[model samples]
Target: MKTMESIENEEAAPRAEHQTETPLESLASIASVLAVGLFVMTFVFQNFEIPSASMVKTLLIGDHVLVDRISLAPPAKWAPFTFYRDIHRGDVIVFLKPGEPDLFLVKRAIGIPGDHIHLRNGVVYLNGVAQKEPYAAMPTSDGDPQHEYNPYRDDFPSIPPDPMYQVTASWQYELPQHIENGDLVVPPGKIFAMGDNRPDSLDGRYWGFVPRENIVGRPMFVYWSFETPADQIEKQSISERLAFMGHILVHIVDQTRWKRTFHLIR
Candidate 1:
């Protein structure tokens, strides 16, 4: 009985002494956690904040969204476990702006490669069929001046783009090359995207096609949303930014759209 008890004490002493991790071991554990977090944020997922009203009811300004970067990315042989798929029509995608590579824009894919597209009276016609876009905020007679129809905006590609409009010079030169039988034909390795707020959005019509490689990811859901001004993104000065940060800190609870928390993005 004594020998048995002695043996048990000897076994228990080592475990008790080792139970409390050394300082080095504790730091190593913390570093491992940080490494995993960094990897997930950089490659697996990313967060973005909407700064414009282009998407309107679909995605409002100041809405922070979680983006799934893996699914839309090109499939890698090393990461065979990750799923990948091609972008389809009507899928809202986040991508770098074609002309301005630094700027990021989110818009719904209207035309994929080889699609014949045109707009008549603000209605999108694809492959000779008019699309039923319930999400699009079309022009209405409700007296909102922003929604009023303009010939160049409503009847797209039919009217020659003028310099008075915000159409890019590069797009004006390339636009005619894609027009066929009064329809804009999407070429290979490119996509035509437009905003949900048709009248207000400065999108594909004004610029050009989005390259397949330029797309970043699809937004999975809105993680947080705050009521912010349309011009908040334009405030670049340090003082102006600090003022807004102070405003957010004070109004974080009340200004936050609690209902939109975790709201799934379509």
Candidate 2:
């Protein structure tokens, strides 16, 4: 028996007041989100920026990649849920440089532990078999003369390490011990890595073996890429770095390599 106007008025009346979150509660919620993000970045994933063209055509300079820190990590009793696996040949890896422990480097694992490795005119022979490496680049006539075929660089340990080739002092002494029948044997708990831009890269050939413990993780994909100069990393001064940062902001829209965004890394 209620009139339409009276029913409408009753329906429009406020039902209940909702409680607003207190400032302290809001802060706690934010803290929880930050904690989760920190844990994920620290233990599960890590961000790395490509500073050199060592892995060019695969990973270019200024390519910001996300590395999966858990997969290649040693298995842990407490973190049984994590999927851990051993490093394998042809896997692109990020690791601390053997001699320069503080420097991080990215390269392709050409030879794993217990593998015999050697190079003949830029061809990688592993375990007495020549590998079909399509990613590797050999020097061309148009390329820099310095990257041209050399005895120590192309022929590897067979020609022996020469002082002019920038071979590490320790590696020069240790190189002979590992060579057997002209092939350099990768000892246990070590990896032989090389760059895709073979001629330009100063990798395992110039240094030495990468320790298993030095392995950080494998890059999953490139999150972002910019057309950065090869020498940008050399600018260590604060003013130079700040100037480049400003330049990036101004040219970001035009210089960003949009096509390479989210590209998968091999």
Q: What is the alpha-carbon lDDT of model 2 when measured against the actual structure?
A: 0.90
lDDT for 171 in candidate 2 is: 91
Q: Give the total clashing residue pairs for model 2.
A: 0
lDDT accuracy of residue 182 in candidate 2: 92
- Candidate 2 off by > 4 Å: 1-18
Report the alpha-carbon TM-score of model 2 versus the true structure: 0.92
Q: Across residues 100-179, which tens digit of lDDT does each residue of candidate 1 receive?
A: 89998999999999999988889999999999988898887778877888788888889888777789999999999999
Q: Tell me each candidate's TM-score.
A: 0.94, 0.92
Q: Considering every candidate listed, which one attains the maximal TM-score?
A: 1
